[model samples]
Target: MGWFGDDSDEAEAYKQVMQRPQELSRWSNQLLGDAAAYEAGKAYEDHVAANGHPDEHHQAKEILAGVIGDFVDREVEVQGLDFIDRDWAKRHAQRRAEIELYDQHGDRW
Candidate 1:
C-alpha cells in the first residue's frame, strides 16, 4: 500500500510559518489604500463636475491596490518567506475593492 501523505504536503506545511507581523502590515495597507482611494475618487469626481472631464483616466482604487500589491511582493522576498501565495493576496484585494466600493456608494456595481 502507498503512504497516506506525499512530500509536497509536508514541504508546504513547513514553508508556511504564520507571518503575523506581515499579515498585520498587509491588513493595514489594504484598509488605508481603500480609504484613500474612496476619498481621492470623490475629489476627482467633484473636480470633474466643476471643471469638465479630463482626457485622462483616473482609477484610484486599482492604482492604490496595485501599488500595495507590489509592496506585498517585495515584503515576501525581504521577509525570507519560502512561499507567498500571490493568488490569495490578489483575492483579498479584489474582495476589499468590492467592499470599499459598496461602502462608499451604497451600490455593489
Candidate 2:
C-alpha cells in the first residue's frame, strides 16, 4: 500500500490526477471544446483501420466513442490553484509522502 492508503487502481489513478492538476486543467479545457470531438473521430477511424477483427474493432470503437463523449460533456473545474492554500498544502504533503514511500521501497508493496 502507498503511504496514503492508495493500494487500488482507482487510488493510483486519483494520485496521478493529483500529481498533474495543471495539465489536467489544460486538457480538460481543451476537451470541453469541439477540437476533442474532431480528434476522437479521427482516432476512431485510425483505430478501425489498424485493427484486424471487424467485430472487435467495432466494439472498441463504441467504447472509445462513449468515453470521448462523456469527457466532452462533463464539467471540469480546476481547483486549488493557490499553492500556499491549506488544501494545496495538504495535497502536496500527501503527494510528497507518496513519493518518499516510492523512493524508499520502489513499488515493492
State every prediction's TM-score relative to the real structure.
0.39, 0.27
Clashing pairs in 2: none
Report how far off residue 37 is in candidate 1 (Å): 11
lDDT of 2 at 89: 29
Model 1 alpha-carbon drift over 4 Å, by segment: 1-58, 106-109
- Predicted structure 2, TM vs. truth: 0.27
Clashes of each: 0, 0
Question: Please, what's the RMSD in Å of model 1?
Answer: 15.2
Clashing pairs in 1: none
Error of 2 at 56 (Å): 8.2
Among the numbered candidates, top lDDT falls to: 1
The Cα error of candidate 1 at residue 17, in Å, is 13
Quick one: how many clashes does candidate 1 have?
0
| Alpha-carbon runs more than 4 Å astray in model 2 | 1-33, 56-61, 66-109
lDDT for residue 91 in candidate 1, whole number 0-100: 50
